[model samples]
Target: MIEVEGVKIDTRHWIGGERVASTRSFPDISPIDERHLGDLDAAGAAEVDQAVTAARAAFPAWAALGPTGRGAILRRVADGIDERREDLARVETRDNGSLLRSHRRGVMPRVAMNFRFFADYAEKLAHPGMEVRGHRERITYDPAGVTAIITPWNAPLMLATWRIGPALAAGNTVVLKPPEWAPLTASLLADIAHEAGLPAGVLNVVQGTGAEAGAPLTRHPGINRLSFTGSVPTAGVIAAAAAPNVVPLSFELGGKSPLLIFADADLDLAVDLAVEQFDNAGQVCLGAFRLLVQEPIAEEFTARVVERARALVQGDPRDERTDVSALISRPHFERVRGFVDRALADGARALLGGGPNTSLNGLYYSPTILADARPGSEILTEEVFGPVLTVQTFADEDEGVRMANETRFGLAATLVTGSAEKAERVSEKLSAGTVWVNCFFVRDLGAPFGGNGKSGIGREGGTYSFDFYCDVKNTVFSPAGWRES
Candidate 1:
């Protein structure tokens, strides 16, 4: 255990494969009870520079390892994560306020899968050569020199792996900056990577607030590529920093995704999905914030959704029976509550819950549903990023699609329909990067994941991820026969 500023912390930053402490540190507070979990070292500009320089120095040897060699290490990393899955899951849940059950059954396993998937992909990656006339041309995919991966607090380790797995698999040295709010699991991951036989300086971690560390890291000349997952405003700031340097970027920002429920859809599944909007306290980027129901069954659908949401148990996240828990922090909880209050003042009726759960001492808010939210209302337009759902009715298929696409965000959308033809047709018309039919949040690691418009800038996962982390160069040379000529 380590202490900074009188507060005790259980973790430290990993720099050049060594544990390092920072001059300044901040307390890590648990949203579950507003308790001080520990103190996290705040990486300032100096630390950021140190991390970047280390990554840059290590890039050559790591890249020289070739895909097969890198893949072997990545596979070992996956095995390490699996070996420590239970402990890592608990750490993540305790640090970030995510349910223990989610980390155990879902998040931790996916972290391992991410490494395994990218390891296999690295081996299968090929840059085939082509013959044009008498010249032989070949395309080579080279790792982007040094990469900076900034992950969000929502799912720290899981999301970090999303970037780390691909970046390392492509042979790029990484300087990962995990969110200060939830930095524990990331620290653990660094230890696991080292144990998996990753060379010193190949992977490094910096921990601090966005202003102190993130800004300098983004602007650092040593970094060749940047991948970020967070809010749009933050993305803009990062983009500006990278602009002068022309560093390639991949951004996965916020979303106010819509879930359309057609007249002929299964009511049971629709209600289940509607309640899922409140999952993770509605902190998910791809969460369904707006519900677009066909006019004929609008009233019934809303009623069922409200009923199901009200039934969710609000208590300790560690409890197996608890369905809803505290928000990430007090400020975030208040911000989410403010959205509900403002929407209510704007004449939107609360169909179920609309206030904090006073019974709970922590930052817990009740699952809320707003009915008859006007077009362009804040509740309908802005991202609440909480357990709040806004319901609107549409008369026809075209109206449903229009209402669903009304927001500037185009990250993800869900459509439930019995008709196969209608599902395909409506999915095509939706502007979101990902469109789900009869399902919500089902992920395939190989599929392209991202958003269109204000949602984000580039895609991640599968070939898309591999392409982003690499620089594809084409080389042409004269054929043997042509050289003779």
Candidate 2:
């Protein structure tokens, strides 16, 4: 156990509202300093089954509580999260090496906001209005049974709750398989849920590798729905595993999002948005990886972005001044490094940082920017998922839209233009789930969020979330009973 903000957090599988020991365990290491934090119990098939069984048993009573009752408990969960904001942020920083300041200022608060928003949303805006002229029609949402949720490591707690809040608010019991790389916060979340009086079996967390824990959870017949946020390969594996059960799946997969900058746009704002890609050391899935700058401003904008990338401080995540920190693990660091190395080898020029930061230990890669990267090159087309951005120039509006849309992934994009007409016209053509105009990472919980193409299979947030968590049914009555009673 590790102590965070006076709370001793146990790194164990939380199933049926209790900590469960496993025959096999894995070491939880801090990416910040490479310290062995604790031995986390790795849940196997048996544990997955146990968690699923518990969720199934709790489904009826949990659903019976209905929206209002469930929302009340979720509100308390949000309060508990808010109360332990410092603790959660600290743990997350140590666990994944995200900057402590970012977590405390934004990530942790957003985690609580997710629960609070969904609780209120499920309580209020879940009903779909329908009108039928010839018959009386009513639509109702019924909670899907046990839901299996697999979250990514980059932003573990926040993403987990993004799925969890809705699943619970929709009155469905959940069995969550957190990414083994950063599983601590998920365990702590279970504690908060229990303290907030969330019933046993209503929320269960099983921690382990994707093959061991995640596969079992996805394949479990007890699960009625599955939601996953991670890589495309992992999603593919999950799909094949869940196909036998034919489990309805909602996937928020990878992205090669583009940041389109026009000449008329605010230069500083465009540079800031470009630099924003390096936030969280560029592990953000929705981050703009490919930068398509209009030719008129390409040279100046690239210079500003390169300068900012060079200035970003890299060191311990606990330091408030630090901008970049360690990658999640050695393998991931190598993966990102490989992407940059290959690009440079293939004649792409590194405008700035191109390798690991020798000044600091561990897996800290310098914020990298590549220029002259060939269009459709691996670095430009693939989801590097690092603090690496590739610069590409577009001659005109049509060219900018073309470059942005020419990708297999369509998760998100950013358009920096002063012209409202250009924003409106270009945004419509961008093949992405969400587009940010003159801003980046600003989110409204009410907006529909997901991706098109290889990015994701379905949307989440607002009614979109409810649509997946609940089985919507329409009840239609024959027109006024032709034979009077």
Candidate 3:
């Protein structure tokens, strides 16, 4: 285990396919107690250069491995992840303050499944069909030279694996720049890659702040592709930096997604899915933050949802009884709290909660539900990445759909309905990349995950994700009559 700030974790930055020690460092805090979990060292610019050089050095050979060999390695990584699933879940719980039950029962399973799904799905990535009507025509798919994967603090390890699994399965070397705020889990996973026997320089992990580590990695001339998951502003900068290099990019940005429930919907099922949508303190990029109910049943639904949210047991992540955990940091906690206060000032009432749990030394906000919320409030319009939900009521189907679509962000949205026809209609009109029918967060490892509009670009979970990290090439075969040149 790597020791830092009184907490020891089995973490290391994997570079050139080996675990390397860090030189410069900062404290890794546990959201639970605001105590120093450990000191995680930053990967200096020199380290980034080394990682990039290694990725470039190994690119040609790895790209030449063909889909079969590349797929095999990815499958093995999936197998290894499953073998160490408990370790991963434990580390994630401590590192991120997510409930152990959720990590073990839900998150870990999806992560491993995603790895295997991509391993098999990569083979189905059919090459473009060619035609030689009068002249020769051909199309071939190949990997982008090197991929720089920058991950966020929320769901760090899982999100990184989703991108890393597909990129490597399609044979692209990777250099991961994890959020310095949430580095341990992702770093540990990379170290595990070495233990699983991946080739040197094929994968690298650099832990540091975005400006120093992420910016340099994105702008690095040697890097040929970028896969990022974070805020929209941050993505704008990354995209601009990579534009000069013309490196292909898959960006999963912010979301102000809406969850709609009609008067005819199943309230019990809606409650369960609603909680799932707000899990990880509503820190995920998928459907979270907003709750829209038909005004006819609005009062009843709000009461039920508030009771359920407040009933949630919040405590140490390690405690099996804990239903929720701490927010990532103090500034984040203050930001969310400040938003809630302003929301109240704008004529909103707290249906459930809006308080700090002082039991924890660090940042901790109670699961909150607000009612009588209007569109003008920032809480209703912007993405609130915390354990908070703002309720907005609409009169009819058209209004609900319009309200759901009225946002700059459209990553994912959900509709709770009994009518299959209505669900399909809503799905078609919704601006989100993925629209869940009767379920808010029933994520499948095999399904494609991404966004449209300001939520960012490209998919990241299955074979389609693999296509994003690769460059397509066309080869024409001539029987001595194929080329006019």
Candidate 4:
């Protein structure tokens, strides 16, 4: 609640075992109202160096806690997140225009699992022994050094935990750069982490803009690994930043995710899935925004989806009955609207509600359905992160898969098929990090979530999550070394 210049910036910086601040700052605006959220001090180069230095310094002591002890702390944090689930959801809703009910019902459960699943697997994460045929040495996994975790604002706390929980559990110290828009949830987690008994510098939270805080954190020589969750373009910057050090980066980037619907698919079930794609107004990087249906069912499915869209009620996220809320800000709303306008210009007809809801001062964009969007139109190809959806028909299964992979992104994909063989076939051809057959957005913390190709590098969630957040060192031992011991 640290508001400056009529803007509320959560200036709470967790560094060197304490929460403090930096001397320099910048303005933060709430997207919901274009109101000044606050002025935030950009963590300067020196602060970045100090934070990374602190992580470097803390790594030895923190990692020395060993697997079991580290797991205990993460597990405790998971329990704490559960205990404060309601508060976290409310804060997240306020900070980023997320649906409170979705956060509580859909997200918190995953957050809890993300912590515990990784914690449970922490001890087992360390390598056993691996040998290559004709090789004289045994290889073991070891933590490289301090990690930088840069996350987007869409699902701030959840994404942050997805990185931090595993990084700490795997015996790596962290420098977490949460999106400036939603720093409060990270701050809250920091407090809970300290109470959960994690060491001071083992988990550090730095609040600042991407250029000021994020770039420096990624480029810092002290950082050995980087895990980022954001857009592809932004992730490109991170990749470039990490390049100088040849630092390994795990990116959970953009998605123009396609939902392939077979003609035989259930129309009722398909419409239900359509709303999930527009979840949180479709701000999700993994949002299933592209709905690619087979030709036979396209017209009916499109109409039914449009009907469902019209039925949606946009209002305050806190309202239990509201099905859709506003986009994150006016800019986002404008961007979404712009995409819709372009679609219509390209001959796509709006079969459902399209445009801003003037009735609501909040960043409300009505759920829109564009029928017959040109194959390469911006709405069809680009990630229109709003309540807008594009419905395109493919003649057959192969064509559906082709249309689905038309974008530069391959983040997440969903396929609905009655035949298991069809799903299996489609799953193989689908180029995404996560493929939910007959489903979408069902997450198990132990399962890996990420994308392929330009969608961004690496994966998140599960035991392997720590791998991206951590650089692995090979500890090779020969018979001679064993003899020496």
Name the candidate that leads on lDDT. 2
State each model's CA lDDT, in order. 0.89, 0.91, 0.80, 0.78
In model 1, how many backbone clashes occur?
0
Worst lDDT 10-window in candidate 4: 1-10
* Structural similarity to truth (TM-score) of each candidate: 0.97, 0.97, 0.94, 0.93
Q: For candidate 4, what is the TM-score?
A: 0.93
Q: Per-residue lDDT for 135-171 in model 4, tens only?
A: 4444444666798988888888888877777787778
Worst 10 residues of 1 by lDDT: 1-10
Where model 2 places Cα greater than 4 Å from the true spot, the runs are 4-7, 126-133, 479-485
Local accuracy of candidate 1 as per-residue lDDT tens digits, 1-485 = 64422333346678887888888998788788888987788898889988988898889999999999999999999999999887887777777888889988999999999999998998887767888897878887898889999999999999999999999999999999998888888887888899999998999999999999899999998899999999999999999999999999999998999999999999998888889888888889999889999999998988888878888998888888889878998889889999999999988999888898888867999888899777898888888888899889999999999999998899999999888999989999999999989999997888999999899998988888888999988899875544443
The Cα error of candidate 1 at residue 188, in Å, is 0.5
Q: For residues 366-441, could you state the per-residue lDDT of candidate 2 as single tens digits? A: 8999999877789989999889989999999998999999999999999999999999999999999999999988
The positional error of residue 91 in candidate 4, measured at the CA in angstroms, is 1.2
Runs off by more than 4 Å, candidate 1: 2-10, 127-129, 480-485
Candidate 2 pairs with clashing backbones? none
Better of 1 and 4 by lDDT: 1
